[model samples]
Target chain A: MLRIFIAITDNEPGVLDRLASTFRRRGFNIHSLTVSPTLDPAVSRFTLVTDLDDKAARAAKSFLERLVNIHSVADVTGTTPLLRDTVLLRVAATGATQAGLFQIANLFQAEVLDVGADSMVLAGSGSPERIEAFMTALRPYGLLEMGRTGAVAMQRCAAAASLETAVSF
Target chain B: MERPPQPPESASASASARAELPGAQIIWRCLEREGVDVVFGYPGGTILPTYDAMVDAKVRHVLARHEQGATHMADGYARASGRTGVVIATSGPGATNLVTGLATAMMDSVPLVAITGQVPSPLLGTDAFQEVDVTGVTIPITKHNYLVRDPRDIAPALREAFALARSGRPGPVLVDITKDAQTRAAVFDWEAAAPRRHLRHVPPPVPDDLLAKAAAMIQGSRRPLILAGHGITLSGAHRALAAFAEKAGIPVAATLLGLDAFPPGHPLFLGFMGMHGSPWTNLAIQEADLLIALGMRFDDRVTGDPATFAPHARKIHVEIDATEVGKNIPVDLALLGDLKDVLDRLEPRTPSLDTGAWLKDLDGMKALFDAPTWPRVRKGEGMSPVDVLKELQAQAPGAVMVSDVGQHQMWEAQVMRHQRPRTLITSGGLGTMGFALPAAIGAKIACPDAEVWAVAGDGGIQMNSQELMTLTQEGLKIGIAVLNNFNLGMVRQWQTHFYGDRRSASTLTISPDFPMLARAYGLRGALARTPGEAAAAIREARAADASTLIEFQVDPEASVYPLIPPGARIQDMIHEPPSQEAPC
Candidate 1:
């Protein structure tokens, strides 16, 4: 099973290296790790995916939090969360197949970014399931090359309780 | 005409408070304020500024031959004196050399503060000469670490480092200060910056329910056993633990590091337990109905297999660190607090129980497995390591024994009759070789009035034998006993049993003349070939005015008896000589 960890850390030169090396040290291979600047430029968010069991996930979460500059580590492995990815798919194309490719692209709500003599590039962004379906459809038309941005996730908020008074412990 | 600068009425009192000094000087001021009088370090280019600052500082700095030795010495000082030991080293290799020692301290939970010099902030990631990420390298091993790129942060970082090293479950902390920061000046206000005591982890209030639960277990236990650990000494709870043992009528079994925490001569003492521990102690643990663990983790050595360990015992762990409660072995209950503080609450609530049958059962096992007396060997015959240790124990009953990890260490732990806590200092958790020689130096420095002995196996003695030069330079009165078995004694023992006596690399075919090496370091040296000679050599070493070394030719095939082979049950002990007794 795949486990996803979202970590917030200070934007520093060695922070990424430190974070990446931590996974390696624990003998967990990072399947897909993506880092991007957050709303606050001083901080960055990292989405890391690894194949780990619940026990290893707990141990890794504790270790990641122990890193010097890591602000927080949340294991979003089993939450009703939003998952997304972006992919650029290039498939062999011609007038004979262009109409069919466009139909498939439209079906997945993808855009045909460019058209070459022999191939065309389709840019797609959606949930992991949608991306997988889009890629699977394009493969039948003779896919040339593909590039994907690994998933980013955020947990859905549950319904709020009564706010007349604060909850007491 | 330089009439000693008049003690300015107000200035003298607050000189350090208002002094604008270089960051390096401020570092020393913080150490001095923390009541640190000694430091062990090896100076290099990056850390030269702090070394230069030391000329005017009041702290005594012992120059270690290697950075590893410096860390071990600092560790020894901490364990012996119950204070945070300080160490300093330069960047890159100098800082890296302290890794082994840092890991050792981390394993044993010793309090140590290590200061390393880093490259200038501008050159940090450029792969500049002698630049390495000391903070990143030590993060996993250290309880906490800091990379101080700014001079203004130096004083506060050092203060925090000291507090972190000493608070809660104490362990090593590293502070990497940049070279540019060290040379820069900062106003070090000692009064304004108060060593961050407020930030220290406050010991939690004892839980009444947990105390009641433990007290109930004690009352209901038929064969109660108390497993004391180094935490008793670290928390100054030896007295409380001993009182609890006596009040509850419980027998106490010590881990290797727990030796002397409870007086070894006490009637309820069951000796140390672990991989190389006594068979009777292990048996007692197996038979115990209630095992009260204080300030000690259930390490793999002590617990052969966590699932099978203490199968009959209801274990209660009293530890400061919550993670250690169920780390290796499951505990029936956990009381998380400082051992001393928890004991203070639990001792009064604990009801004394009548456990005479349990005591009798344990005594019978002990008597059955007691070390049997062997026929005396003559002048030309090689002495057994156990016999040599027995003689040493008889001669120096109260001396502090610092042992290097190996067969001799086990022999010393098994044979020595320790009477008090903090008297037997050895690398228990890490089982570090080459620790004894330098650690004894630090121990002697910490306790000048006490007799200190560095007991090492032939393989271990050679690891840090260079520290003998440090001993001579300091003129410390210490004794060193080298159990010379001409092989890696412990590994050889395992090979003889498990590997069909292949021997392989266990034997040390050619080695240095240890006594001659001792003489080269300006110490009295002697060689003992037989039991009488070994005893005489020990006497001579003890009587010397300066530090001395005694090398004993121990029998090569003499293995630690009543061994529990790896992955074997605690009860399945292979008694000595293989043929003398069957596996119990």
Candidate 2:
């Protein structure tokens, strides 16, 4: 099963390497990982997707949390967290296919970032499933180039809580 | 010299009492504050500044022949003294040499702090001479590591490194300081530079529900066995383990590294268990109904094949590290906390069980399977490794034996009697060779009053034999026992069993005379070619006030018996050949 883990770690040099090394050393298969600065400048948040069973996932969480730089690690897969992946695609399109492409983009709520002489760049952000569907819908136009920010996740919160209070180490 | 005006006592007083010093001086000052009196290291270009500052530092520096030996010494020091061991080295190869030692410490959960000097900040990542990403290379091996480009971060980094090294599930931590960082002066405030309070990884409190579950399991178990591990020694829970075993009437079986955790001759002690472990103890584990695993990760060597390991047993893993609980063999219940604390809380709730029949059965198996009469030596053959270890055990009863990896290590584990925790220091986890001689130096340095002996095989002793000079230079009274069997005994044994005896590179076609080599280093040396001669040499080495090396020429074909073939079940153990004369 795929498990999503949200980790808050110290925003220091080599923190990313350490985090990645932890997963690699334990032979944990990471399907996707997204890391960015959090509201607290001193800390960074990571959204990691790994393929593991329930027990192995718990073991991975325990192992990652043991890193001194990591403040906390939470398995948010069961929480139905809002997961998003931003993808940019440049498709081979001519003026003849522009209208249809715009319509297809509109249907999926994707934005046309640029319109080239013979191609268009489209950007989309949504759940991985939606992203996959959007890519399938646009594949007929001939994708020239593509880039994606692997799935980042956030819990649907009922109230605001500080990072310190949200997780008990 | 005129005394400086004293600051008035106030909340800010400590903050104001700061000393302006270079990063290298700050390193020593922090170590002093951490109560580290000695460090094992070698000097190099990048680390020259620190070496120069050592003249003024109160800490004694033991110069090592190689960086690897230095790290092992620090590791041995940590294991013997129950304190964080410290090692310092230069960048690139120097730092890389510490890798094996660091991994060894990491595997056994030994607390160590490694300080390495990096290329100057400007030259970092530019492929400067002797420049390597030490921290990056050590990331997977170290519990945590720091690379300080700024002089101000030195004190805090060292403080944090020491704290983390000795914290929960202790392991090695590294601090790499750039040359410029070590040279530049900075304000050092011991109080202000203290590691954050939350840096400590405190294990959660033992849950009442888990204790209740464990207690219920114990009450229901008819043939429970306590699998005492290194954690008992690490957590100082030997007493608790014994108390719980006596209270519950469970036989205690120790892992290889866990040999000294429980006294060897205790009635409840079932002997060490794992690959090359005693047959009866392995059989007991296979037959037991409950296995209480404490402070030890179930390494592959211990559980031959996890699928067939303790088939009928419901394991209760009591560990400090949460990751180890279900990493190897799945456990029915996991009690997470310090072993001593967990055992103390669970002891009262544990109902005393009547396991008289179970104990009697185990005793019968032990008597039947463990009885091995010594084979009388033929006139021309050399002594056996067992005979040497037995004589050494009898002569140096209270000595701390630091063993190198391979056949001698296993034989020492099997033949020697360990009465106290931390007495037998060996490379259990990583199984690194050449660990004994240098590690024994570290152990002797850590426990000056205790007798320390380094026991290594012919192949292993040659790995770090140069450290004999360091042993003599430091004037440490360590006994070096080299079982010169003329081959890499363990590998040869494997070839003899599974590889059609195709020795390949296992045989040492040429090797040094270890006794002469020891003498060349200005140390006492002795050679023994028979059991009686080996006993006399061991007695003489014990009686000598100076460090002595005794070379015992043992049978090259002698193999560690009761061996479990790789991936084989414990019950499928291959005992010593029935036609051959038995080992003592």
Candidate 3:
């Protein structure tokens, strides 16, 4: 079973390698990993998904936590956390399938970002489950190219958000 | 300014005024401040700056024939004197060569500081000559490591490296500095930059409640066994361990590296406990109900299969490193602190236990399943490895024995009698070959007043035989014993027991005249075919002021018995073929 682990670490040379190598060395196969700068400029955040067993997962967590530069590691797996993956798909857009493609995109709440003579580029971002279904729906449209941002996640917060505070694309 | 009529510029003032010195000089200054009087290393391209700086430093450097030997020598020095060993080498191959030594030190928790000079910062990742990611290479093998890009960071990094190395749960640490960093000048302030006060590792105080819990466990134990390890020696807690054992009337068994931490002939001493440990020691551990594991990680060799290791024991793991408390074996109580401090606190509060029946049972087991013994041999019969080790120990009673891995290592552990702590230095973890000869040189250098012996198997001695030149160059009076069985005896033994006795490639056909080989290094070498000859050869080496190598042509068929087959339980040990009374 896949599990998601989040780590906050110092943005230093070889720190990423140290994190990735910890998983590799422990034989923990990472399925998806997304890394980016956190709000704290000095620290970077990593969201990793692996299929390690319970024992191996605990060992890996402890092992990664022991790295000198790592600040904290949290296993957000099965925590009902908010997990997202973004995908940009460039697919053929002809008269026969254009309507059906647009219908599928609408159903998944995907946006048609670019439209050309015979092709259209669609952008979608949502939970990993929604993204997987969206990708499958777009696969039959003679897909030419695609790019995906690996799963990034965070624990659900209880704070309420106003219209001005919430931003959506 | 003239109000004080200051005493004519003291050395401290002079040091502050003369702050501008090469980075390499700072390295030496830091090492000197850390009380490193001797260093074992070999110089190369990237490390030339440090070697050049050594001219002004007061520290003595022993030039090893190989980098690996240098690391092992430093390790041996640490194990012998309880001081952190220092080794210096260059980048690329020079740095990589120290990997085995670093790993060996890592496995055995030896306090070692390895300094490697890297290619200039500009050429770091450009694949320049003698450029390698020394820090990256040594990350897993070292307790901590630093890659010095700026010259100013040298002193602090070195200081930190030494502190981390010699601190809690001591292990090897590496400091890799760029050649430019070492060659460039940096402002060195001894007091302000190198804060010696902040570097000490003050072990955390043991909690009273935890000690009470541990005490109660000991009080409840009827068959208590103390599994002492290197931590006892590292903490200088041998006396405390012995006192506690006596107070509680618990029998103590030392781990492979822990062999010398307790007196050899004490009634409570049950001998070394592990794979090739005495049959009685293994049985005692298996039968004991309470195991007080001190400073040992319960390595696979000791535990065999974690599931079945000491199946009846309720463990109290007293370790300095918290990560190791329950990493291998479950514990009923964990008293995490410095072994000496913990044992000291426990000793006074602990009441004498009535373990008379347990002790009697252990004594019975000891006599029933004693260490393997060989029949009295006539001349022309090759010497047994145990006999060779016993003869060597008999001759050099106070000598520190540094043994390489394999059959001879086990024999030395089982047969040699140790009266002091830090006396038996070997690669217990990792089990690296070629460790003995170089480590002996280091141990001898550390304690020049004491004799040092390098006990190695024929296959193992050849792994670092080139270090004989280093021994000769240093003019160390170390005795080297090569237990030659004309084969890799341990592997051959495995084949004999598990693989239908097909001795595939384990047998050595091409051979060297070991004594003649020693003579090539300008040292005396001798060959001993019998036990009497082995004794005389050792005596000859002891008499000589220079180093000597005595190659004992040992019995090829002889093997270490009471073996724990790989993946087998500790209780399921295979006894010797000739003495198969009960296979218990």
Per-candidate DockQ values are: 0.12, 0.52, 0.10
Give a tens-digit lDDT track for model 2, residues A76-103.
8888888999999999999899998999
Q: Give the higher-lDDT candidate: 2 or 3.
A: 2
Candidate number of the best lDDT: 2
Across the candidates, what are chain A's individual TM-scores? 0.90, 0.89, 0.85
lDDT of 1 by residue, A4-65 (tens): 88887767666876777778877888988888877677667888889998767777786676
Residue range B177-290, candidate 2, lDDT tens digits: 999888887777777677863343577889999999999999999999999889999999999888898899889999988999887888898887998888888899999999
Most TM-score-accurate candidate: 2
lDDT of each residue in B90-111, candidate 3, tens digit only: 8999999999999999989899
Residue B280 C-alpha lDDT in model 1: 78
Which model scores highest in DockQ? Answer: 2
Tens digit of lDDT per residue, candidate 1, span B154-192? 777788788778888899999999898899776676664
Question: Ranking under lDDT, best-scoring first?
Answer: 2, 3, 1
lDDT of each: 0.83, 0.88, 0.84
Q: Where in model 2 is the C-alpha error above 4 Å?
A: A158-164, A167-169, B1-17, B197-200, B370-380, B577-584
For model 2 the TM-score comes to 0.95
Q: What is the TM-score of chain B in candidate 3?
A: 0.94
CA shift of B148, model 3, Å: 1.9
